[model samples]
Target: MNNDSLSAKPHYPILDGLRGVAAIIVVTFHLTEPLGTGHLDILVNHGYLAVDFFFLLSGFVIGYAYDDRWHNMTIGTFFKRRIERLQPMVVLGMVLGAIGFYFTDSTIWPLIHTIPLWKMLLVLLIGCTILPVPLALDIRGWQEMHPLNSVGWSLFFEYIANILYAIGIRKLSKTALGLLVLIAAVALAHLAITSPAGDVSGGWTLNAEQVRVGITRTMYPFFAGLLLSRTAKPTHIKHAFLGCSFLIASVLYMPRIGGTDHVWMNGVYESVCIIIVFPLIVYLGASGVIHTQAERRICKFLGDISYPLYLVHYPLVYFYVAWISNHQGVTLVQAWPSALLILLGGITLAYASLKWYDEPVRKWLRTKLG
Candidate 1:
C-alpha cells in the first residue's frame, strides 16, 4: 500500500456513520447530564465513552489515510491537512461558546459578569490554537482548559496523537507498536481502576492527573486502532453497522457495574470496554458495506455533519444546562420537548455550518495550500 494507492482508497462509510451516531449520543448525554446526580443515575450512563470511541476511530482513519502516505507527506504537510480538516470547527465552536457565555448566566455559573470581556477574548484566542489553559486563567470555573468549548480538550490530545504518529509511531514495526499498545493498555487499566470516580472520565482539566488520564486514554485504543488497521483483513459481514451500533449502545448504556463499595469493578468494566469492545466495533463498522441507496444517503449525511455536530453542540448545551439550572423543579418529562428542541437545533446548526462555513473554508484552504 504505497502513498498514492492508499490516498486513493475509498472511505469506510459504515465507520463514518457510526461516528455520527456516537456524536449524537454525546449530545444527548450532555443534554441529560443535568437530569441526574451521578453516573449511576445519569440518563445516558456511558455517553462520555463516546470520546474514547472517537479516539479509536480517529486512529484507524489516520492510519488508513496516511500511514503509507508518510513516504511522500512531510510532517508539515500532515499537520496542515489535519488543521484544515479540523481547525475550522474548532474556531467556530470557540466563537459560538464565547457568544453564548453571557447568556449562560445562571446559579450554576454565576460569575460570568465578573469575567472581563478582554479575558474572554483572550481565552477564545487561546482556544483557537487548541491549547489548554491553566487553572490560574480559568474563567468558567469548571477548570476546563478551553472553558469556552470544553470539548476542545479532546482535540488537544488528538493533535498530540497526530504529532506522535508523524514523528515516530508511523515508522514502528508491528511488533513494536503491539508492545506500545500493550503498555498503554496497562496504564489505561490502572488509571481506570484507581480513579476516585470509578471511571476513566476526568481528562478536560490541565492538572497532572487529568493530563495522565487524557494521554492514557489516547494511547491504547488509538494505537490499537492503528494496529488493527495494519493487520486485520475485512471480511463479509451481515448487518455489521447495525450490530456494531447495538454493541456500542449496549456497552454505553450498561448500568454502573459496581457501587461505591466495589469501585474497581466498574473501572474494570470501563477498561474492558475501551480496550476490547471499542476496537471490535470499529472493525465491524469498517468491514461492512452499505447495501441500499437509503442507507448510503443516511451514512453520507451523518458522516458529513458528525465533526461539526460534535464541535458545535456543546455551547448550546451550556445554555440548556443553565436554563435547567434556573428552573430547579423541572423533570425530564416536563423538559422532554425542550430537549427535543436542543437536539434538533444542534443537528440543524451542524448541517448549516458544514454546508455553509466548514466546507467553503476547507475548499479555500485546500486551493491555497494543497
Candidate 2:
C-alpha cells in the first residue's frame, strides 16, 4: 500500500492483482469449508496455502521497500509506518466481527451469547492491538486467538515476521540468510509431512504445536522472498501476470491428494507449492510489464481492495458458517445463491472500507504520525 514517487522504484501492479485473486479464492475456500465433513473433503481443498503465498509477497515487498532505507529510517519509524498501514483495518475488522458475533447461530459456537459483554469487549480491545489472547479468552469455542476475527492469527504472525526482519533478519549476509532459509525449509517439510493431517494447517490457536506450525510456515517463504528480492535478476517475461495467475489458481484449486492412507502425498504437494512454486510466481510478477491501460486499471482496482477484502470478509463468513450449521441438509448446490451474495457483498464491503475508512484514516494518521 505504499505510494509511488517521482524517485521511488516503480510499483509491481501484477503482484497486487495476484494478491486480490488469491484473497477471492480464500473467500471461496471459507464459503465451502463448512460443507465438508472435514478438511480432507473441502471443495477448495488447498486454498489455505494462500496464507503462505501472502507471507512471501509481504517479505518481498518489505525487502524491496525498506532494505535500503535503514540508513534513513529508525526502527520506531518503520513500526509506525506499518501500524499506520495495517492497524486501521485491524480495528475495523474486529469491530465488524464483534457486531456480528452475537447474532450468529451455530451448534459449533453455543457459547457466544453466554459470554459476558465485558469479556467480549476485552477480547475486542486486545484484538485491536493484534495480540493473541489465551485459550481462556476464546469465547467462540474455535480456539482462535482472536475469536472476533479468526484471521487475525495470521496477522499476528505477520507482525512477528516483520519484527524479525527489522531487528535482525535484514542484517544477515546473503549466505547466512540463505542458510537460515534452508533450515526453515527442512523444518517446514518435516512438519508438513509428519503432521496428523499431513498438510501443515493448524496455526490459529495459541499453543506450542500451532506456534511451531505458524513459525515454520512463516519463515521459509518470507525469507526466501527476502533472498529473492536481494538477488533476483528480473527479465521481461511475456504475459507474466496471466501465466502466474493460472499457476496460482491451479495450485490452490487442486483437489486434496493422498487419501487417509497416504497423507504425505498431500504434504509433499503443499511443501512444493510453498517452497518452490510461490517464489517463482513472485519473481515473475516482479518482472511483469502491463501491456495496456485496461490491464493496468484492473490491476490497480484489485490491488487497492486486496487487503481490505482479506481483513473484512471473514466476519460475514462467520454468519454463513452459522447458517450452514443451523440448516443441516442444505447442499452446496442449494446454497449457491447465498455464497454468491457473500462473494459480491464482500467485494462491495471491501471497496467501501478501503475508500470510506481506510484511506482517510490512513491519511490522517500519516500526517499525525509521520
Candidate 3:
C-alpha cells in the first residue's frame, strides 16, 4: 500500500486503541466516586494521570503531523486550521450544555451552576484562544464561563503550542525543548513546596478550585511531553529504557490521597518522581519502535472521541447519578448499571459529534485552509 492514498496504508492502530483505553480509564476514574470514596484503588484512581499522558501524546502527534508545514504556513492559516478542527464540536457541546443547564433550572444549585447566553459566548471566545487574562461571566459567581468545557482548558495550551511551533520552533523544536526544561523546573519547585506542605486543601478533584490548582501542577508534565516531541527518534533499546523509567518513578512516588502532610516529605517526593517519569513516558510513547498494531488502534479511537467524552461526561454523570438517586433506589453498587449506560451514551454522542460535526469541519478546513 502506498502512503499517499487515504487507505493505501493503515495508520497506526495501536495508538488509536490506546486512546480508547485512556478514555475508559478516565471514565472509570470519574465513576470511582460512586464506587467508593476515600477508599483508594491505585489502578483506577491513578488513571487521573492519563491527562498527563494525553498532553504528552498531544505534543508528539502535533510534532509528527504538522512540524514539517510549520515554516511554510502563515500564523493566520495555522489558527484557522485549528479553529476548523477544534471549535465546531466544542461549540456544539457548549451550546447543547447551555441549553441543558437552562432547561434543568440549575440557577438554584449551590455550586453556582447556571449558563446564560453571554456566558456561553464568552466560553466560545475562550475556546478560540487561551487568553492570559481571566474572562468571567456572572452566572452564579465569578468563574470562567464555560464549565461544560472544562476539559477544553487544555486546548488553550495546545493553541499556545501551535503558536510556538509556527515561530520557527518546528525547525529543531527548540521551543519544545525549552518548554521541557521550564516545566521540569516548575514541577520540581511545586513538588518541593507541596511535599513539605502536604496535599493542598483538595488533592486533585473536579471542583473548580481543584481544577485551578491542578493546572498549575500539570505544567511540568505537559512540558515533559513537549521534550519527548522534540527528541530525535530513538532506537528500540532507548525506547525500552524510557518506558521503564516511567514505570519505576510512578511506583516509587505514588502520591498520597488526601491533604499534603508538611511534616512528611511525600508530596515533594512524588513531585520529583513524576517530573522525571513524565518525560520518560513521553519518550517511549513517541518512539515509533514502541508502537504496536493494537495499541495504535485503541489510542486513535479514544483520542478521536476523547475531547467530546471529556467535555460532556461530567454533566451526563451528574444527571445519571441524580436519576438513579431519586427513583431507582440505586446504591453505589447498583449505580453500575447507570454508570455503564452513561458511558455508552456518552460514547454514542461522541461518535455522532465526531462523524457529523468534527469530521465535516476538519474536511472543510483541510480543503480550504490547508
Candidate 4:
C-alpha cells in the first residue's frame, strides 16, 4: 500500500481509547461540586490535564499524518480540511448557546456581559485561524470561558499549531523556539503574580486569573509534542522508563519546587506525560496490546463514540443539575446516579448522531475535498 494511504497501518487506535478516557475524566471532574475545596477537587480538577493530553496528541497525530508533506503542505489544503472538520460543530454549539442565551429564562446578564453575539461571531471567525490569545481576550469570565462551545478554546490552539507547523519558521530551531517561548511564559506569570516581597496580594488576583492563564499556557505541551515529533525514537523500554520517570518526578516535585499552581506548570506536566505515555500508546496500538476480539470491539466502539461524548456531555450535565434542583436536597452521591444515566443517554444520542450525522458529513466532505 502507498504510505500516504489512510488505511496504511492505522497507527493510533489506542490514542482513541485515550481520548475516551480523557473525556470520561472531564465528565467525572465536572460531575462533582468540589470546585472550592478538598483534595479530591485537586485530583478531579486535574481533568484539565486531559486538555494537555489532547494538545500533545494533536501535535503528534498532525505530525504523523502530514510529516511526509511537512515541508510542502500547502496552507490551503491544511486549513481547508481543518475548517471542514471544525466549523460545523462550532456553528452548532454557537447556535445552541445563542438560543439559550436569548430565549432561555436563566440569566441573560452574564452572557451579555461576557460575550455578545457580535463578539462571539468574531471569535468563531478569527478563532478558525488559531488565534487563541485574541479569542481568549474576546471571551472573558467563567460564563464566557468556553462561550458557545466549551471545548472551542483548545480547538483554537490546535488549529494555531497546525498553521504554525504548515507555515514553518526561520532562524531558530523548533525546539529552541519552543523552549524560549515556554520560559518567557513562565517568567511572565511569575512577574504577574509572584513577588520578591511575598504574595502581597495574597493570591486573590493570582487565583482569579489562574484558569485563563492556564489554558493559554497549555500550548507548551503541544509544542513539546511537536518537538517530540521532530526527533522521534522508536519505542523502547529504556525510553519509556525515562519518560515515565520524568513525568512522575515532575508531577511530584513540581509542587515542592513551588509554582505548580501556575498555568505554565500544566504545560510542563502535560509535556512530561506525553513524553512518557505517547510512545507506549503508539507501541501498543501498533503491536496490538489488546489484540483480543473483545478488546478490539470495545476500543473501537469507545473510540468511535468519544468525540460525540465530548461534545454532548457538558451541557447535559449542567442542564440535568438545573432540572433536578427543585425536588429536594440531592447530594452528590444521589445526583451521581442520575448523572450517569444522563451520560448514558447522551452516549446513545451520540452514537446515533455519529451514524446519522458525523459519518455522512465526513464522507461528503472527504469526497468533495479529496
Who wins the TM-score comparison? Answer: 2
TM-score rank order = 2, 1, 3, 4
lDDT of 1 by residue, 243-294 (tens): 8878888887777878878888989999999999999898889889788889
Q: What is the C-alpha RMSD of each candidate to the true structure, in Å?
A: 2.4, 1.4, 6.1, 7.1
The TM-scores of all predictions, comma-separated, are 0.97, 0.98, 0.70, 0.68
Query: lDDT per model, in order?
Result: 0.87, 0.90, 0.52, 0.50
Each prediction's total of clashing residue pairs, residues at least 3 apart in sequence or on different chains, is 0, 0, 32, 0
Predicted candidate 3 versus true structure: per-residue lDDT over 218-328, tens digit per residue: 455544545555565644443343344346334433444444324235454445545655555545543434345554454566667876676566656556534543454
Segments in model 4 whose C-alpha atoms lie over 4 Å from true places: 1-5, 33-43, 98-146, 169-216, 236-288, 321-329
- The lDDT leader among the candidates is 2
lDDT for each residue of candidate 2 in 82-123, tens digit (9 for 90 to 100):
888889999999999999999994787999879999999999
Candidate 2 vs candidate 4, TM-score winner: 2
lDDT tens readout by residue for model 4, 1-370: 0011136645545556555655666666556533224322333434554565666656666666666664665778877676666555455444444444433223322344445667757755553343343334435334333544455555554555666767763224866866754773464345334433211111101134544444344445555555555565544233332233244233332221123355444444434444455444544333334445665566567667766666656555545534444444556666777777866776786678678876777678878887
